[model samples]
Target: MKHYLLFAAGKDRPGIVAAISRILYRHGCNMADSTMTRIASEFAMLLIFQAPAGWRAERIGQELQRCEKRLGLFTGIKPLASSESRALKPKGRAHIISVYGADRPGIVYRVSRCLASKRINITHVSTHRTETSRAAGYVMLLEVELPSLRMAAGLNKSLGRLASGMGLHVSMRPVETAKL
Candidate 1:
């Protein structure tokens, strides 16, 4: 089997997943992993799938292109190399880091820079901005891999200092991998 990645984005609406999955089913593609969500008014999907031998990325791209108008989505497909198709295996224990603060620029930049400096690996991140008549709020959730408990302790201290300086709430907790 050959692995491929697919990305699609369009206005949010009912039947988007059904339509796309139907296409993949007809094409003999078995979805391996996928993420689909709405960001504001737009819906986006990223899927890693496997195709039967002899299937070509160009062929799938053309097929998806024909459906773009009907589906109201901009789609792209890419063939994955053998190494690129492997699943991620982080070299440390998984953790979830939470950040909440007043809406401000540079929050992600500063936080991500700190993580990079610690050599932490961020696997997933999602952030939201909330607005009300009173004020705006920011929330960020990051799934990261910490190298060790010792490193986590140092990181917690650093994050404490960062939170105190920026007037934000930052916390970290181990993810229950067994539950996952």
Candidate 2:
């Protein structure tokens, strides 16, 4: 079996998932994990799947040749190594940060850079910008892993300070996970 990471994006529309899944199904691909979402009229996807032996990258490409173009999607595929024995999980506790305020530049960069400076890892992020609601001009939800929960208070304070300067509201809280 071969592991692959597939990315697909295009204008949001109906039947996109079915079309993509059909290609994988025909090629005997088993989807391990995937995320599909629409951001401002654009549909984006990140999929991890296992392809049966003998399905080369070129073959996979050929199989989707018509699918992407027909569906107006842009696609990319890359082979991924599955060496679990050599992988080590980062030492940290998960935290979710919420930020929302008027839309402007530097919000994402500044917040992300702050976490980067501390070697914090961002596992996932979702953002939305709205023109209809006055509640929040822009909103971002980020999932980050902190080196220690002991520093949550201090870090949250710093984040609050940073966000306040930018006229935004920010809050951070730990995420509880279950093994089973």
Candidate 3:
């Protein structure tokens, strides 16, 4: 079996998953991993599937086009590259960086810039504005992969300075891996 990645997006509505899954079922594809979410008004999905031998990406694209036409969605399919199929394995510590402050521009910029300078890798990031406590509040949560040789103390110090200058609260802690 060969792996392929599918990207699908469309206006938010019910039954999108059913439509896509039905197509996959008809094609003898096995879904290995998938993520689906609504970012703003659009529904988006990224899926990885294993296709039986002789199943070409182009054929999948054609089937997905038919699905798009029937469901009023947009779909794209591509074969996953051998190198891209292997997921990243973190070496050192995993930490969560949280930032909260008055909603304003450049909060993500300033914070991410500092992390970038230190060669830190951001594995996941979720940012949003919410009405809690302050009238206008911004929150940023980032899952970071810290280098094995870097000290957490030094990284925290740098982040503290950056937060102070930006008038934001910043905290970094080791992320718990096990689930209860």
Candidate 4:
């Protein structure tokens, strides 16, 4: 079987999965992994599926288009290269980083740049602006993978310097993951 990555986005509504799954079922596709979420007012889905070896990517995309038309979703598909598939899994320590400050531009960019320079991989991130003391404030929660050589203290120090420069409060803590 060959693996393919599917991306779909549309207005948030019910039955999106049923529509997508029906098409996949007809095409003899098996969903191996997937994540679906609502971002803002839009619904987005990312799926990794396996199909028969001879299946053409274009044919699956056409099927997806048909499903999209029926469900009012916009869809895209790509065949994942073997190397790409291997790199998605996280390695090293998993940590959660949080930053809070008065709402302003460049908070995310600055913090992300610092992490990027250190080769830190961000697995997931969520940010929001909310009212605080009659003023707007921002909060960001980031799940990141820290390199084996860098302990939590090192990460904290780096984040602290970035936060000091940006006038933000930053905290980093290791997250314990239990295998099921």
Candidates' TM-scores?
A: 0.92, 0.88, 0.86, 0.87
Which residue pairs in model 2 clash with each other?
none
Prediction 3 global C-alpha lDDT: 0.86
User: 35-150, model 3: which lDDT tens digit per residue?
Assistant: 99997788999998888898777766777788898778988877887667667688668999999988888999988998889888998899988886648889999988888636
The reply for model 1, stretches above 4 Å from the true place, is 177-180
Using TM-score as the measure, name the better of candidate 2 and candidate 3. Answer: 2
Q: Lowest-lDDT window of 10 residues in candidate 1? A: 58-67
In model 4, where is the ten-residue run with the lowest total lDDT?
Answer: 82-91
Best by lDDT: 1
Better of 3 and 4 by TM-score: 4
The local distance difference test score of each candidate is: 0.89, 0.85, 0.86, 0.85
Tell me the spans in candidate 4 whose CA falls farther than 4 Å from its real position.
Answer: 86-89, 131-133, 149-151, 178-180
**How many clashing pairs in candidate 4?**
0
- True-vs-predicted CA distance for residue 10, candidate 2, Å: 0.9
**Top candidate, metric TM-score:** 1
Q: Can you write out model 1's per-residue Cα lDDT over 5-114, one digit (the tens) per residue?
A: 99999999898888888888988989988999999999999999999889877766666876688779999888898788898677889899999999888889989999
For model 3, give the 10-residue run with minimal summed lDDT.
82-91
What is the overall TM-score of model 4 with all chains considered together? 0.87
How many angstroms is residue 167 displaced in model 3 relative to the true structure, after the best TM-score fit? 1.4
